[model samples]
Target: MNNQQFQTPIEYLKGVGLSRADVLKKELQIYNFEDLLKHFPYKYIDRTRFYKVREIQPDMPYVQVLARLTQKEIIGEKRTKRLIAQAHDDTGTIELVWFQGIKWVEKMLVPGKVYVLFGKPGFFNNKAQMAHPEMELYIPGAQQKGNLTLQPAYNSTEKLKQFTLDSKGLQKLIAGLLEQTAKDIHENLPDYIRNRYKLAGRQESYRNIHFPNDANQLNEARYRLKFEELFFLQLKLLRNKLLRTQKFKGNIFESVGDYFNEFYHHKLPFALTNSQKRVLKEIRLDTQRGVQMNRLLQGDVGSGKTVVALMSMLIAIDNGFQTCIMAPTEILANQHYQTIKSLVGEGFIEVALLTGSVPNKARKVIHQKLEDGTLNILIGTHALIEDKVQYKNLGLVVIDEQHRFGVEQRAKLWRKNIIPPHILVMTATPIPRTLAMTMYGDLDISVIDELPAGRKPIQTVHFYEAQRLRMFGFMKDEIAKGRQIYVVYPLIKESEKLDLKNLMDGTEIMSREFPLPKYRISIVHGKLKPAEKEFEMQRFVKGETQIMVATTVIEVGVNIPNASVMIVENAERFGLSQLHQLRGRVGRGAEQSFCILMSNEKLSHDGRIRLNTMVKTNNGFEIAEIDMQLRGPGNIEGTQQSGVLDLKVADLTTDQEILQQARNLVIEIFEKDPQLAAPENQILNLAFQAKNAGLSWDKIS
Candidate 1:
């Protein structure tokens, strides 16, 4: 691939000079010719049809009309002023209006001259009109340009629009670049692979993508581009996984000794589900293979992931090595420590908890034991990665809610061991399969799909504010049965912009309703200090408080078996994944639990879909799929940080088939030529290198 042509500065483009290039770079991150080329259009409009003036209707989406301007007038005054022009064809006359660029429109409008106007039609005063329609001069006896079909619509910012670089302007610039370097565009795929897929040529795809001759050409162009995008992504991810497996050697756990056997046979708390057993087998096989195991363990809340993680940790201990688990928050770290400590029993495993809140004296003793190899397992927050917290023979590292931590922090943990310990990252949020394929494709994934026996699925319901009395009665009934309740608000304090109930105000209302002696209420939110928050949480956990009024901060970490009912105030403000996680907080106990979604009578289309989806199912994966469809992959929590979903064309939600095909092809190619050293595979290597010139692959590996 010739880098010089594509690397040319955007300022040199025919339509964009230095000033416009600066705005393009800042607003859209388009710096060079290659960046501009990769900036694919979001949508397209058909340009082959021209509607007569009489055929235009208010409901028409976007129409093009060939008409001559018969009259022009400036109407209204000040900010409301607009330039209006009457245009007529053989059938009738329609109005065209421009509110902002009145002077420009006035100068462009030449009375009695025919022009082509295109825009969405709107009804004003019972007549059809178009606002800010695009205009082009009409030539007599001129041939239509090769049956032009679709016009690409590039996304532009208001800043770029100031320089006259809207979607159409951008289309013109791309056309110029394509015309100048049509021959310079290089094919990144190998000839054999392209033939197998029956894809269009790279240059041809680009030309048709920006300026297609027909719908068939446009469809072919989109297929080729989407395939190429997904193919390269899968190739990059697979190559990283292959390279890591080949280059890195891991400590081998040859035997499942006393530690693992004792836990399974004698200390086991509950029967392992089939899914759990299968996952355990997979982990055991990975550890015994003597290669670094980078695995992702995905399970919904209350799915018993901790038990699986502990069992895996025991394998490390059985091999005479220590293990450590890192969590994103101190509350979560403390919870894991307490749960694991009790489960392991005294003297079964010397487990220690280390967080910033730990006293200095306790920290000193923990550090000493860690260095002496006495602490068999350590659980902590970011404090675990401190320079002083050294581990002796660290063999396994487990990260809970791994997405919350940054890549550099994870790297810090990887460096603690000489030959990088085997990593097992766990998340309560179930990832959609398509997302897992792209985001965590490098890591082997094992999902605990089935819940443990004797657990009941939480029932979810929705309620409007008018049903507040009924909800209150239900809460009182649960409390009367010795069960606790959680009332979660979305905000800490009242916001002038949002009318939803805040935590403080909600607590006040609950206090007035429940009263003191019989009902005790606790409030927790992000605004409270750490100690204060912990106090309230402990109160709720201890059953001292009948209800806990809180924010989403309690979405994770707080697991109380007695809390059977969770009423989320203004649930419409929360996303599907968040609602699922919050619901997971309940249903921890064998008792039947319920999640009540409270909202106003009015709901937006997306808000209604989200709440409806939550009420329909408790399956985290199903909710995740819907959430991805509703908010795209970028908006999903923690996905934007991964940088893997920087997709230009292929959507993870809709293009699963394409992604799967691309992944299969990647596997076949790597299986045949792992190093891409074969003559036919060289193009794949070059393409990967050119595309990811300065990107970091540490996270992928």
Candidate 2:
């Protein structure tokens, strides 16, 4: 259809008035004709098949039968009232009942009249019946003439149903729309793409998607639509990357100076793994290229990403530029500050920490040093992005746990320098390949898959509640060995619905079991104030407390090398990624480390799979892949807000092949027509613009 016609509001449609249009928009977000057209069916039923009354089985999904009503009855009083009718065919009779709309159903049911019935069959009192079955008057020799194999089913809500806009009503509106505008639908993909993919015309695809004549046509229609969706998504991401590389000039760090060399040769704590070396090379190459580097660094917990980020910062400093690291939380910011400070020593290079809690007196000094270019490296939480915080020559920005920050916050960091600074985003939560490609497709990705040397792998084990005494004994033994332990509970307080073990009750039990002066336990949770939590955390970090009992608040920043045991209570309540992060709290020392997963006996199928997977492997990527399959991409920890996975048809887990093909095709298209200025490619450019008009990120580098 022409652009104006497709954008026409639904209230102008034949069957939809103002009230119905409002419901459509509120319920399904269908504002215009194009949106209604793109609303594909969730499932379909075979319309050609008709079943005998006797053939109606309780196990049948949905059956259609031609029958006549012989008797009608209304039973029960108000609210619980129901309308029942006996429908009979040549073989036998079955009852049809409606608990809702009883008065209307009684008027619609006519005795001794043939009707078409379709619904799921169930057994009640040893007899087959259908509840709230769809019914229509049947006429002999009046069926539509075509290869009608399937009838589409659309999703509807109770609010829409009240306005008679359920699946059947939506089907009628869509049918009317197609009859008027099917031929007017315009082709969006270029001729070359259509020819390469052997795709059907856009009009035919939309037609078959809603009302398919055969299975082959429906399959082809689905593929064409899925391909188009993925193709455009890739095109947008690749175009953004191209624009950034071409338009933005980055500060070049030409050489590695004395700071890098000194840290590498004399002051380094451990030998760098090959994977770490490889990632450093990648970052080094990007910084020297003179193109603004937007890169994502993915690694498992305790994978030494902080060291690589520090080394990259050193390169920026070598080139006479300032650098900063932005973290999501104050605790994590302090952790990074302490680690970097100890590694760099007191006199080698100047480093400072800025957070919300910094006093005004200290803040003035930091702001002065930053403006004068004396602060070589500054690390802080979101305070780094405040309006007053200015840098002399901010060249490299390393964002820790980048996903926790929003796009606008990162953009603020970019605007701090005259030219956008080189960005290195670090995340310990490993993302699956498909997710990384789609969500952060504009950024180059480098993964550190290997752990550092001399660090032993954490041994993981699962235990049922019946083994509580045994698990407690193991904890006691570990504590007696001068190793600290973390006992993580899922909830801070008791949840009546979840029946999970809370920190309060668990702490009480622990105090009773281990008792008084022999053991000390520190407690922290989300409800605690920052200062209060820090106080408890410090007790554990200093080894004054042998056990730290807390919630998932300890999932990220607290790093105590002496802690050798992680006990997760009610482990089934946590996702795999959270469990993995909690497990990473231990195993930092030279001694052996253990992660004990404690759950009840009756674990759900998904919960069992999650716990079993944790017990099976330590590979973060493997766990992420399984988690994506189980929870899907939308529910993954940091991906829900990306909007890239707001896909209608393409499944990230199953449609990897299609996504890859679309990306490759995007590359080829750009190579041939970089600006999409060619006449044949104008349609593609226009479609892209129409789809992403006001989204600033789509156009910005």
Q: By TM-score, who's the top model here? A: 1
lDDT of 2: 0.90
Instruction: Give the Cα lDDT of each candidate.
Output: 0.90, 0.90
lDDT of candidate 2 over 158-233, digit per residue (tens): 9999999999899999999999888888899988889998998988999999998778888899888889988898
Which residue ranges in model 2 land beyond 4 Å of their true spot?
9-18, 52-56, 66-93, 98-115, 137-141, 144-149, 697-701
Each candidate structure's TM-score, on Cα atoms with residue i matched to residue i, is 0.95, 0.93
Model 1 clash count equals 0
Which stretches of model 1 miss by more than 4 angstroms?
A: 68-92, 96-114, 144-148, 694-701
**475-530, model 1: which lDDT tens digit per residue?**
99999999999898999888999999988889888998899999999988898899
In model 1, residue pairs whose N, Cα or C atoms come closer than 3 Å (at least 3 residues apart or on different chains), thus clashing, are none
Clashes of 2: 3
